[model samples]
Target: MCQLLGLNCATPTDASFSFTGFCQRGGATDHHADGWGIAFFEGRGLRLFVDHQCAAESRMAEFLRSYPLKSRNIIAHVRKATIGDVRLENAHPFSRELWGRHWVFAHNGDLKDYQPRLHSQFQPVGTTDSERAFCWLMQELAKSHAGLPSVEELTLTLRELLPQVRRFGSINFLLSNGDALWAHCSTKLHYLVRQHPFTQATLMDQDWTVNFAELNQPGDRAAVIVTTPLTRNEQWTAFEPDELKVFVDGLPVEVA
Candidate 1:
């Protein structure tokens, strides 16, 4: 299995802190050393980066450590190559245009014998089941709605679609379209929110600490969703088995 990391915030925030720990699984701390990718949402646009090298050795990953690209929504992944070759085209956090906005997706689990009938509107550029699933999802959404659907309506549609995909294998994923972030878990996932009374946080993978109280205002809030806790101090909540959650403006508003 691979590892996933995501963030949704009320204000633009850099993910260097959380990513420090998340990257460790790609090589240094764990054995998920196949490929890695990350995406940042800015307004209606998105910035994405991916590398075929292990996160610990990838120069792209090194740049990410210092690149303070702030964004309200972010999605990232480190692959262990359950399918497809360890190449850049097969990296996660794939992006495609939908509803006039960029939709980004990343998957952490493997799918077995998962081939879905898809339309030609969007096709997979890579051979990985992860990318194919993403294309299938976008294609389905496009066929389901003539125009952008309301959040409530779209959520209902997604709830129905996800189960069919999960039938193949583990289906943990993070998806975002600049407007909101959606996360689903078939096996393992966890999340946490930091709000007003922000406290200091220390990373578990590195010797670093930050006092959020000193950097954030009383109204500032940020939410982190990951496969595991990134910090040693802050409390993190684990997602229930086979659960799905949606985060809007950094807080989980819908959970199922």
Candidate 2:
């Protein structure tokens, strides 16, 4: 299994605080040490990074610990290889183009005998089941919708497709285009929203603290979703076993 991290914000925001804790699970606090990757959406472009080394030991992850690459939507993953070898190409947080927009995906669980036919346009470069699932998803989305479909329609399609995906194994994941972020939970997922009147928070996995009131503006709003709670003080809400959520502009929106 792997760990997932996501961010959706009203304004461009950095993920150093949450990422610090998330990185700890890569090899320090937990055992998901196969590989790790992250993607940050910047307008129409994306900043993507991946490494096959353990995030806790990788210098790349250390750089991300302090780097404040701001973005409106972000997806990250720390992998523990279950279906693929420990290689750079096997890392999570894979990306591809869809409907003229870049879409990023990361998986936290394994699938058993879950191969699906894929078109040549979106074939996976990696052998991991996570990447295969991502390609399948993009393939279906492309075949079903010529371009970006309505949010409701996308959600409905996702809800219908999720059950078939679950037949393989746990399918918790984070997905995003530049505009919005989507999260699906099969076992564990938690999230917190920070907005105006935000309070001080402390990381559960690291000895760090942040007073949101001092750094955030009155209009700033952010939603962070993770496989586990990232902070010790904030009241993180846990998603149900089979729940799916969509975040738009750093806020959770209705899902059918």
Candidate 3:
């Protein structure tokens, strides 16, 4: 199994705080240390980093913890390598281009004997089931619409397609395209939204705290999703089993 983390914001925001705490689970506080990767979406471009080393000890992860790269959408994963080899290419948070927009995906669970036919343009570069699933999702989306569809429309399509894959195994995942974040949960997932009248929050996995009121403006808002609660002080809502939700502008939007 693995761990997932996602951030969506109304304004460009740095995920260093959340990422630092999440990285601890890679080896220090937890044991999903086979590999780790992250993707940040800046406008239409994407900055991706992957490493085969444990995130808790990787020099690259340490640099990322210090570097404040701001993005409206971000997805990260710490892997335990159930379905793939422990290599850079097999890391989660895989990226691809769809309708000329860069899309990022990360999975937290494994699939058994799950190999979907990928005859379209999208293909996996690695042997991970997670990558294969991502390519297949992109391939199907490309076929369903001539171009990028509305968030609502995309949600409908995903709701229809995801169950087919989930039948094979757990399919908890996070996906984003710099516009909105789509999260699907088969077992465990939680989310929190930080907005006006922000309060102080403490990390669950580390001895760290942050006062949102002091660091953010009144208009600033952010939505965070993870496989488990990341903060000890914040109220995190657990997603219902087999639930799919879409987040836009730092808030959950009804996509029916």
Strongest candidate by lDDT: 3
Give the alpha carbon lDDT tens digit for every residue of 1-256 in model 1.
7999999999998888888788988999889899999999999989999988999788889889888999999999999998899888998989999879899999988899988887667888889999989999999889889888876677778888988898899889999999888988889999999988889999888888999989888767888999988998888999987788888888998633
Residues 147-248, candidate 3: write the lDDT tens digits.
999999999999999988998899999999999999999999999999999999999999999999998999999999999999999999999999999999
In angstroms, the error of model 1 at 82 is 0.8
Q: Candidate 2 or 3, higher TM-score?
A: 3
Among these predicted structures, which one has the highest TM-score? 3
Question: What TM-score fits each model?
Answer: 0.97, 0.97, 0.99
Clashing pairs in 1: none
Clashes of 3: 0
**Candidate 1 vs 2: which has more lDDT:** 2
What TM value does model 1 have? 0.97
Write down the TM-score for model 3. 0.99
Q: Which residue ranges in model 1 land beyond 4 Å of their true spot?
A: none
RMSD of each: 1.2, 1.1, 0.6
- Please list the residue runs of candidate 2 whose C-alpha ends up more than 4 Å from where it truly belongs after superposition: none
